[model samples]
Target: MSILVYAEHDNKNLKTETNKTVTAALKIGGDVHVLVAGTNCQSVAEQAAKITGVNKVLVADNAAYEHQLAENVSALVLEIAADYDTIMATALTTGKNFMPRVAALLDVAQISDIIDVESADTFVRPIYAGNAIATVKSLDTKKVLTVRATAFDAAGSDNSAEIVTLSNVTDAGISSHVKDELTVSARPDLGAASIVISGGRGMQNGDNFKLLDGIADKLGAAIGASRAAVDAGFVPNDMQVGQTGKIVAPDLYIAVGISGAIQHLAGMKDSKVIVAINKDPEAPIFQVADYGLEADLFDALPELEAKL
Candidate 1:
């Protein structure tokens, strides 16, 4: 039996999340081969070969495969699906966009955001916005899974495997294009950050968000927001952390003035250390907090900022 992992990358460089997916795939105890499907991504294929537990690297390089358009990618991955018993990818935008199509082509349900491996074919995953855990056993001959990076430790880059360049067999025609305009930030992404500090509706306005900025800078933490704060226009939708937003599992999570709703907890409950600061002792956020401070956020901000 062998496992196939999809390597996520830009045309030039591989994303770190690929290692996390590979780590999860390694737990299944099989030869791991990563498939890199894109134009001019031979370097990324080589990079994937350097990751530990990868037995071989497959590159489907073609000019038409640029941009990893879901149509082109799904077609390429499906062509090689019969060769492996299990296929996996990171649960990023790219994987979420294309893996479902591959699963459909194979007539099997895709196990999304898997957190644990029960056995070779059985797995544990989250559902209902992480409020429930589902244990699934795949009876199909082939299995396709997407791993939640935050739920698993990434693989180390210590292995030296051979790179095997594969021919691009699929017609890489895209009906639509997705272009990216990246906003560069010194702060890390919330989902992958080790520390996170999120604000809520108590901050009142966007201007007050700056109060958390200095503390975040001191703590070297990614900034996050509650759904209520995002809806109040205090922050952008990307900063939201809740059932409707991103899931995070940071080493430390500090929530200021955020009344923890079950939805909000669903996103951050996996964090190792949770700290909640709110004036109301009855706030639900205190239930999951490792440290709780009941005080006005406005008065506490400067003190917390000074201490940090």
Candidate 2:
């Protein structure tokens, strides 16, 4: 069986998630090929060709694919869908947006956020806000999968695969490029950080997040927030970590003043080590924390920052 992985890049650099997704594809036992779709993204294609298990790299350099609009990318994937048995992408914003369109167009089941591959057809995915693991067998001849990158090790760069350019392009004029309001931060990307420090409603206000800034800078950690913090306007929605937000598996996760709602646990439960700091000893976060400290954050933050 041949597998096609959708390369995730920013035209210049390949995202680590793509390498992790490739690892998932390799585990499915196939000749792995990566599809790099973007305008002026030849650099990304070249980088993908070096991934350890990739057999070939397909490049579709066109303006329509530059922004990776779901309408256009889905159509492009469908054009070559017959060449591969499985099509996979990282379970990120981009993949979550377009993979369903491809599945719907092909009239097949789209397995979402698969954490494990039991076989070529049977996969293990989280369900019910990650409260359960569901093993599903897809009856469709063609499998379209969105892999959770945090579950797999990234594929190393060890080989030089042949690169093939494609002329087939799709442009759905229904959408157009618009302005992007991005939060520019010097800190590490939240999903890829080795250490993450997060706050919750207990933070009270946005200015108080500075308490984490000193600690984050000391450890070179990324800052995250619970859905409560976001809802309470203590931080932007992008900084939220929960079932409805970003998924992370950092080596060390620190929860500050979080009550440990199940939705919040679903996002960072995979962290190698978890530390919870809350005034209430009975907070559910202590249940999953490797280290639990009962203290007032106002007092603890300064002490921790000084100690670090």
Give the best candidate by TM-score: 2
lDDT accuracy of residue 228 in candidate 1: 94
TM-score of each: 0.93, 0.98
lDDT by residue for model 2 over 1-308, one digit each (tens)? 99999998878888889999999998999899999999999999989999999999999999999989999999999999999999999998889999999999989999999999999999999999899999999999999999999999999998899999999989989998897787899999998899999999888899999999999999999999999999998899999888899999999999999999999999999999999999999999999999999999999999999998
Candidate 1 structure quality by residue, lDDT tens digits, 11-31: 788887899889889898898
Pairs in steric clash, model 1: none
lDDT of 1 at 267: 85
- Quantify all predictions' global Cα lDDT against the true fold: 0.89, 0.95
The superposed Cα distance between candidate 2 and the true structure at residue 135, in angstroms, equals 0.5
Clashing residue pairs found in predicted model 2:
none
Mind sharing the TM-score for model 2?
Answer: 0.98
Residue 152 of model 1, lDDT score: 84
